[model samples]
Target chain A: MTAHASPIGPGPTGPGPTAPPPAPPAVSPLRLVATLGISGALAGLLLVSVHRVTEPVIAAHKQRVLEDAVLEVLAGPTSYRTLYLVDGAFTPDLPAGADPRTLDTVYAGLGDDGARLDGFAIPASKPGFQDKVSLLFGWEPKDGTVRAIRVLESRETPGLGDRIEKDPAFAAGFVGRTTPLVGVKAGRGTGAPSEVDMITGATISSRTVIDAIDTTLARLRPALDAYAAEAAR
Target chain B: MKETTAREDLLRGIWRENPVLVQMLGLCPTLAVTNSVANSLAMGIATAFVLLGSSVLVASVKRLVPGEVRISAYVLIIATFVTVADMALEALAPGIHKALGAFIALIVVNCIILGRQEAFASKRPVGRAALDALGTGAGFVIALVLMGSVREVLGSGSFLGHPLFGAHYEPWVVMILPPGGFLTLGSILIALSWLRRRRAAAAGEARS
Candidate 1:
């Protein structure tokens, strides 16, 4: 192998022209088995130790991020009450009022001390270019004006569609808008009372954000009216 | 214990054995995190730190790793270093830690680290293995940074969040999307192939 490698017409430079390196002497199977056993045990030990130490911190950060998003939607004076949606109509849960798991959602924000501040709808689904546009929306108690829109997850193309998640201007539009499938007009900003600016070159993205808001708002308004009527009575 | 050839361990990883452009290892970070020079730099250094730690530990214990279960054992070792990296990043730079998201934990699957231990580190002296790991890590960083800078400049009209081109330069919206990553990487590969052919032709002329 050494003699063959020495010179093969000026020695191979490219991978196609080059020769494989000389093979090293082989060892016995028993030795290989012992080596594997020891390494496996040691590596497993180190991994578990590290995971135990870091799990808390990782979990805390994740929790904090979610809390912050929820709170942002529930802004102003607030309290979070767990509600059971028994049959998809803001109803309560399983085990007979044991905080229904099958269809329960977190109804957030009363007042400084259980006073009525506002109500929010947590609408989560995969849509748009990347298939994960999770959002939290706060609608005012009456008229369903949008108070805020919080993006939880999205994988849209940066600059174009990602503007939905990152651009303050695009998000600022979501605030103060009243609902029903109305995407902000292309190019120039729409001068309507409930309108936001569409991204300059992302028509598909603009439509997605509008559709998400529209769908969420459509379901929310009727339920919100029912809740309002319940409160009045 | 017998030692492996240093030249084989070194040059193999740099080109024909590259961890990113050639080997196509660790595509998640290669695409998601490489959006800017700053992001790429942060990811690169984090990766290099983990590679160094894991290579040392894996090589030291190579004699004991069972051949039948080496793959599982290698993942265990790699995961530990990745956790250490995650912890350090969280403590020192919480901002970057959030920005990186699951990519930090995803490093557990990064083929560069495991590929080194399985192919080179476990079979070689500790020092030579470290050098090979460093070379491969460094090459990956360079490729990531290059890819990120190209996208940031063309897509967002910024460089590390700073403006390089004036407002007159219209942003190429497609450059920051998923397709943009593939686009830039493809063109770069073509350019690299072209350069190699030009260099090879030059060499042949001199020889003749």
Candidate 2:
């Protein structure tokens, strides 16, 4: 087979063909298999080596990011522990044979005394304008209000819908807001305990954030209340 | 096979045949990540690394592969390099990696890297292939940065992350959005063609 010419290049400039090129020799199947096998093996070896080297680093980076987000939402908790919900109850330890990734989990933060419960940083995600928007918010059971919020992941439209994450004003509006939060027009928030001003051009995305929190709280509030009561006891 | 000088191979992709601006290859990543200068630079460097590494490997192993499996072999090599780039970026520069997101993995399918392996690297010596890859990589970087600068300044009223026009400047929000990418790229293409035509006209006038 003739070599495929690239249109990106200045077309073939080989020495002026004095005559037509000679017919190419046929290739054997054995050589083709050998070539592919060798290539695959080499590729595998390179990937394995790189993966081994970077796996720990990538894991550490992810761990740090999660910890930082949790701490930020929880307002500098002295310590935090992962709690998994299984069979209608929250457990501090992972259940046998259950992947931590697939289970509902929250990070419970402790105050400076290391024994007093500060609050919980709960992560939730829901469909937004472009893709799923994932976020973490601190829920204070004492006051039954959202303490702080941070957007962990989002693919919203930049400079518009993305303001749900990038705009501090929008994020601040969620702080100290009660459940069943109401989204009002921008600059029209009545300063009520549960009122949040939606971003001007990102009403849907803004609402998605509120809805995700509300849905998550509705599903997990009973379990959280039980956990809080047990801790109080 | 054509005999390309080292200089020609090194310089061709930069201006005469830029991968993004001139040839329009890899436009997906070009448009997706060029909203900010930092993201654009990270993407450019990552793509350049993959292209250069794959070109060298393909050139070194050109003789061993039969024509029937050349494409597969090249893809395997390119994918390996892309994976390595992805891992390294995630570990070393997590922020940039997060900003780039799926575009880094999408580099595996970029036509520019595979196109070079098929056309230039497979047919040329190792040195020539390396030079060509560097040239193409540089061209890609320049085009991305150019688009990024225009979009960031107009879209956010900032260059990089620093505000350029103070607080009063009202950013043309459309410049940084999806439409901004296309608008900036189209404007650049128009400007490039206009420049080329002007140069051609000048040359014609001199000749006449």
Top candidate, metric lDDT: 2
Q: Residue by residue across A1-233, what tens digits does model 2's lDDT show?
A: 01233464335422223232232378788878887887899889989999999999999989988998999989769589899999998989898899999889998999888877889999999999999999999999877799899998897987789988899888998999998688899878778888888999899999999999999999999999899888888
Model 2 lDDT on a 0 to 1 scale: 0.87
TM-scores for all predictions: 0.74, 0.89
Off by over 4 Å in 1: A1-49, A78-104, A114-117, A184-201, A217-233, B1-18, B21-32, B83-109
Instruction: State model 1's lDDT.
Output: 0.69
Candidate 1: residue A67 Cα off by (Å): 3.8
Model 1, residue B52: C-alpha shift (Å): 2.8
Q: Return the lDDT, model 1, position A177.
A: 76
- Judged by DockQ cut-offs, the docking class of candidate 2 is acceptable
Best by DockQ: 2
Which 10 successive residues of model 1 chain A have the least lDDT summed? A1-10
> What DockQ, between 0 and 1, does each candidate earn?
0.27, 0.44
Q: Residue-wise lDDT of candidate 1 within A82-165, one digit each (tens)?
A: 444445455423445463434535455566667453566465454788676877766665766777777767877765788788
